[model samples]
Target chain A: MNEHSLTAEIIAILRKAPSVALFSHVSPDGDCLGSMLAIGLALESLGKTVTFFNPDPVPAGLTFLPGAERVQQVLPQPKPQTLVFVDCTDLRRVSLTPDYLRDSIVVNIDHHISNQRFGHFNWVDDQASACAEIVLSLINQLGVTINRDIATNLYTAIVTDSGCFQYSNTTANTHRLTAELIEVGLNLALIHHNIFDQKPLAQVKLLQAALNTLELRAGGRLAVMSLTLEDFQKSGAQQELSEGLVNHARSIQGVEVAVLLKEVGPQEIKIGLRSNLWLNVNEIAAQFGGGGHKRAAGCTLNVSLAEAKQGVCQAIEEGLEIGRDH
Target chain B: MNEHSLTAEIIAILRKAPSVALFSHVSPDGDCLGSMLAIGLALESLGKTVTFFNPDPVPAGLTFLPGAERVQQVLPQPKPQTLVFVDCTDLRRVSLTPDYLRDSIVVNIDHHISNQRFGHFNWVDDQASACAEIVLSLINQLGVTINRDIATNLYTAIVTDSGCFQYSNTTANTHRLTAELIEVGLNLALIHHNIFDQKPLAQVKLLQAALNTLELRAGGRLAVMSLTLEDFQKSGAQQELSEGLVNHARSIQGVEVAVLLKEVGPQEIKIGLRSNLWLNVNEIAAQFGGGGHKRAAGCTLNVSLAEAKQGVCQAIEEGLEIGRDH
Candidate 1:
């Protein structure tokens, strides 16, 4: 369906629905959690029963969202008349049983270009910076007065998904909508600090360990960093804290491609690749039986850390050469 | 003068001036640099001879600004008809000879709360998030169309001064202006990447060394980190790279006060202090012959690093105790 008609259909179904259930991808981040909460709160305000479901618990950093505590692991009873999937590119990402909800009207709302139209009503806009941006438009169309609490949730979603407005996906309309949301009295600092700052001591320790092993290749064009299992144990940091570590390597002045290899087991390693402008790491991840976006991609290699590092760095060098030639 | 009349007076002067000279504080930050460039570019487009002056060279990160190369270290000849001091809390900050332009009409434009209004026309609005915001208004009132270059400069000013819109000073108007600037075809990601993401490898090395010495004082209520001159020399990092090191310490989960002591010489030490919520560090800095806002402050001590750290940490502990009692 065209975006206009799909949006209208979704709105029409939502307005008359007796109950609505919201599902987001597993291991939800700020965008999914904030989008779910904002829409659920809006529906509740309209006197409709709303159930928010997440396959995995909200990450530690994003629990501050207003309605985060209400997210349930299992689908609620009294089957929802309307099922809205937000921020999930694939239906399996939601990790919910597909058999029971066959009768309900399905609505897929996402901002990802890769979103599969797994719903009866699909409204996907790749240009939207975040799913929350789409939700904001829907709320405005529904004539719902966005209260302060709802505004805060929406703001969190945009800020996190846009990397606090630093990402390329952030557009002019993103800032305009953010301005309108702030008008509803959002505390930009409190939310920003709680989300970006307030890092645990262990995280910094892990960062230190990760940087200690930093290496440069391709005449400073490639930056490689690694963390052994021992480093995580020594720092008392969980493996999750290693997230964004490769970005550190990519931040180097002359580096184009950054790779991080983490030892998950004695002979197993997880490889992450990040590129600055030109190099496409997704193809490199595909060779390793995984894939992601152009600038960021990842894969798991059942090889020793040293072997994985050598193979990934060689692949990135070839990619960079190809990119330069192009 | 009231803010309304002050803004009107400045606008009137700019409209009629044959030429204008722009002055920002020495060691200019993103806000000052961005504000100066935006206004100067706008005036230059109006066929006015504009001279942009800064006592210190543009910092490495901000040299990406469009007009950064045009900023002069020394005063230019044929004095301008109008002298506009932007982003300066005090006249001395501009560091220009006081006698050279004593008779010129001085316009002080700032957003700092402590501005002294030391200008024939003063437009100081602390409520405005950044001085760049004020410049945006003045350009609009002057009826100058904001081009892509001017928009980039103004956006840089706001993003830097507002800490990427995370600081408390950011308001609804800030985002609105940012959205307008974005509409002018500013590349948000390129500017953000150049300003925030492109850190030198030396800076990361310096960070590693500083984190190695991370110390917790006052029973974990205070976190302290120190780096000696040798550490800078060995890591190939300059003293300026230590600007935000204290923020890392302040980010610890429970730490109320975070301090960074840098050895400037055998005896002199440069100190930076940051507070999360309670316990005013500015008062503590004042006790040591320095002062600033309640949360972030700085000072210099002509004592050994060991002595300075001990004294400052004790003062912070006492302040925390007093704050708790209150």
Candidate 2:
């Protein structure tokens, strides 16, 4: 089966199966749910029996995705000969699988460069903006309908993955695909608001706390903000609600780099990085066993938040050598 | 006093002036304040006596811009040779200017394509994205020293005028100029929050009320939501707080056109328009004597809320014939 070729691969396996199970990685993002739902909707239009699954509940923010209600938290038994995972690199990221389908023929689709070759038919193309991009490529190849519903789902994936087309990762192909999506009548306003604007009152309160903690460092070249578990609890903020606070640091004038260290658990911390110039954050992240792109990247440390912050600061200090006056 | 000429125009006048008074448009946006403030700062740096006046209080949201506190609500009594106006096309829009300056030479600089050529020495370069963009070009010509504060203010002007580089008006010059501003170390994070992300609780509540009234029209191609004066008063939403609301209307799936009409006064309404493919809202707005570029536009109607809605809907209906498919 031609699993590596996005369209031929999805078609090759589903051609033989009377029923198919579709799913995504847990803690679903717009790319994960959007790709899965858009593909599931397209496949369902083709008279194919499709069951969609996710390991965890979809975040409330992404509930507007097409076919969202059809997705279940786990795969069921009596699964067909085909199982397709959209935006998931491996089964470990999936919450549950039907016992009988543990050994079922699996197809994996994703846009993560770190994707592990984890399935019988894996098509991982990181060049695409999102899994939804690959899904649309396949659907178009299969001559499936590109209606408003599918257009919305695909638009969501692209917009989310592109950071509304402001992130450095956006390429010419991203714009081309976006133009095509626009041709299909994508609603730019709704997608922007539903995904980026639907912040709760709790999130704003969280931002207030984060803003209060902003510190200027490195001769005003580095801006850092942090959140202790206590801060989160007091603000009634969840990890998700902490979105866009690091942006405050990166937003300051003269700051070359911005860092956010959040205490995720009792002794665990996650670092988020953003830069205005040549700080190779991906290199910094790799020094700590995490990796991502140049302008933005992240890492996690097993140590307490304080130690993790110090470690991140060290990485940033070294990174700034390459960043200044270049 | 040849303001429109690249020749020794404002330069000659400023060199002879003992002191200068500057102001910006009414309903001041970032571009207006940022451009005026930047010019004021640069002139002050050059050992020129300057007093910046703004009759209206800085809109609560824009207080984060540097040197905002230095802007006075009332101009100090002083005889000045020239009064500089920024970003405004009409004399009616001047916020804070001494009545004595009406006899002095007026130097009006703007980027409004529709500017009526209303000043003694008017330089209106509508091709520029913002008045700040024009200011930057003029400053470079004058060999004025540009520093971080000036750059930060200039950056705000372009970012706001270009809608953070997402509006159709964004150009190669916009990006190039922004890239230069970033090199000077402007805090885009604070700028974004101050200009884009800072929403009052009342505005949020007003948004919820607006979203509650969303409806799909024109064969699932038009989405609309409106606000009565009651809605704004109940939520304490000020006129400036309605900045990004039109975007909400254009976000609905399958929406080709979006309309947002708000009560501007007890008996008047203001209309905002946005179009995806297959709609031309600019032409509709033109019928009411308002003009803007295609894709987005606005108009004001002196009618009761009910009559305004009827008139706008009729125009939208009449203008649909020319809406594009791609």
For model 2, how does the per-residue alpha-carbon lDDT over A21-96 read when each residue is reduced to its tens digit? 8878877888888888888888888888999888888877788887888888756567677888888766677865
DockQ of 2: 0.05
**What would the per-residue lDDT of candidate 1 be over residues B215-295, giving only the tens digit for each residue?**
888788899999999999998898988788788888887788999999988999989999887778788889999999888
Error of 1 at B30 (Å): 1.7
Model 1 misplaced stretches (Cα beyond 4 Å): A217-219, A282-293, A299-303, A310-323, B1-5, B215-222, B267-271, B283-290, B298-325
Tally clashing residue pairs in candidate 1.
0
In angstroms, give how far residue A187 of model 2 lies from its true place.
Answer: 3.7
Give the Cα error of residue A200 in candidate 1, in Å: 3.4
User: What lDDT is reached at residue B5 by model 1?
Assistant: 77
lDDT of 2 at B115: 87
**For each candidate, what's the DockQ?**
0.66, 0.05
